[model samples]
Target: MSEHLFSALRRWPDIEAPNLFAVDASDRLILDEAESQLADIQPGELVIMGDNYGALTLGAAALHGCTGIRVFQDSLVGELALASNAGDLADRYRTHTLDRALLADARLVLLQLPRSLAELDEWAQAIARFAAPDVTVIAGGRIKHMTLAMNEVLVRSFDVVNVGRARQKSRTLTAMGARRSLERPRYPATSVLREPEIPVVELAVSAHGGAFAGATLDIGTRFLLTFLPEMKSDAASAIDLGSGTGVLAASLALARPDLHVVAIDQSTAAVASTRETANANGVGARIDAFREDALTERPTASADLIVCNPPFHSGATVHAAVALRMLADARRVLKPGGELWVVFNTYLGYRDYLNRTVGPTRQAGRNSKFTVAVSVRA
Candidate 1:
């Protein structure tokens, strides 16, 4: 039954990756490890966090007939995939965020180990604070991605952090024994990165654990900023697609006072981070930050210019479908003769995609690792 569930699953968006092959070896290992406790895990007491695409949740439910399962996935895409995969019409599994509602009395938690120590720390903290006193957390990740630091993070929130045997190049961390909850959570780390060219200007960036780069200036973004002066914003409506912390939006708003900037990202954490950064940079009035699925809902021909440093990685796999999707959306929302300025890895071969999707494309800047190009919407 569990194998059927895994085979039937599909990743939403069906991008460059295979939808039929959504479940990975790590997922199989996590499910195999969790199934041993199926008889002990009571219905409605099992919570799954960060299930990439409903593999753990649906597999558990279908395998053990577990109902009322609570699930928390940070990605909207993943959440949608869960509903679609389960044919969820009733409240078979309820969707929740990282909170007491998700963890309330949860006796068994199956989590996909995050790459960042800070993210794992926040998850462990929340699980400890709200889950049952005797809750067991089985967190699994690929062997190559697992590190000793993850155990260190879990140990801070739990009394015991035990490593499980590696199976099929995957390993699980068994965390038990809860500790006293901290008075305040450690997420949304805040810092200030001042513009060197304009010493008087600074951006206060606040990043939740899941945010990309965590309130730091990425090299691609830093390179993209140099071309901001080259843009003519007489049309006054500019968008920063895939805006991580609204750095580009804030910088553009500060440099071009006449322009109204909108920063959009798919991650909820990114939306919050971008809003905080814009407000702290004193351009809140001119900059609006919102969570969106790649400008799909934006009005056609509404924007004059769009800037983006599209992520080559969507979920765990490295692919160009996401960047292509973003470029297509940017083209749709840009007015005739409008332009899209996008930065990508030089080897991703995105320049040709941009040229065909938009109009004529020109190279604006380049380094060994990244390329910044401008494309006019036909």
Candidate 2:
């Protein structure tokens, strides 16, 4: 039954392509590893983290009759996909942000190991700080993405870390004996950016573990910032689509104190980071951070300008669909004659695509690796 359910799950509201999948071997292996625990736990004791879709949560409910499960997914799209995939099992699980509420009294946790060590540390610390004394965490990931450091990170919060045998190129780590006396969470890492090239004198960037680039400015965003002076000067409202760490949003707000800026990203971590970054920069009042799939919540033709540094990859798979979807949303949300400015790797050749998708496009700026383009909505 679990196999059939996993097979039927879909990654909708996310980029669904041949290479991208809702469930993977890691999800299967994690479930297999936690089968005994799942059977032993009562309703509401099972907590799932990093479920790509509904596979882990729905599979547990279907196979073990577990209900009232608390689940936390970093991406808004992942949460929506889980709801969309949870046909009759929808009421079995509830969603929560990663906090004490999600982990409180959880005796069994099934985690899909994230690629970032900082993320793993944050999860480990949270489980140790909030979960039941006897909680058992079963974390799994593809062997290629897993590292010895993951086990090391778990060891800091758990007295024991056991490595399971690899199956189907995936492996699980069993962590037991949570150390509730451990140090406080070291997340929402903060940094001060003093780059002379930045529009603002100094920008405060804050990020939780899972936010992309984590409290640091990625080069793509740095290149995109160079063209800010050329953006629509009289625009009253702007959106930082795919905003990571709220650097662009905060920078824009600081540069233009009167302009209202919105920071949107699918990741819960990114939204939190953006809010923290904005607040730290003293622009939180002017910036609104939301966990959204692109601009799905914004009305059509509402935004005056949209700035994006679109991602080229969906999860670990490099695909064009992710960026294309963002571009389409930007086109839809911008008012007539409004501008959409974007920075992307030069090799992707987005000039012609932007021309066809948004409007007549022009090269705003370019370096060897990145190209910034501006498209006026027609």
**Cα lDDT over the full model 2:** 0.90
Best by lDDT: 2
The estimated TM-scores of all candidates read 0.93, 0.98
lDDT of 1 by residue, 23-57 (tens): 88888888778787766777789999998888888
Model 2 residue 378 CA deviation (Å) reads 1.9
- Residue pair clashes in candidate 2: none
What TM-score should be assigned to candidate 2?
A: 0.98
**Per-residue accuracy of model 2 over 1-378 as CA lDDT, tens digit each:** 776888899999888878678899998899888888888899889999999888889889998899999999998888999999998999999999999999999999999999889888988999999999999999999999999999999998999999999999999999999998846579989999998658877888898999999978899998998888899999999999999899999888888988999889999889999999998989999999888888889999888999999999766667877898878867789999899999999999989999998999999988989999999999
What residue runs in model 2 are displaced by over 4 Å at the alpha carbon? none
Return the top candidate by TM-score: 2
lDDT, each prediction: 0.83, 0.90
Q: Look at candidate 1 and give me any clashing residue pairs.
A: none
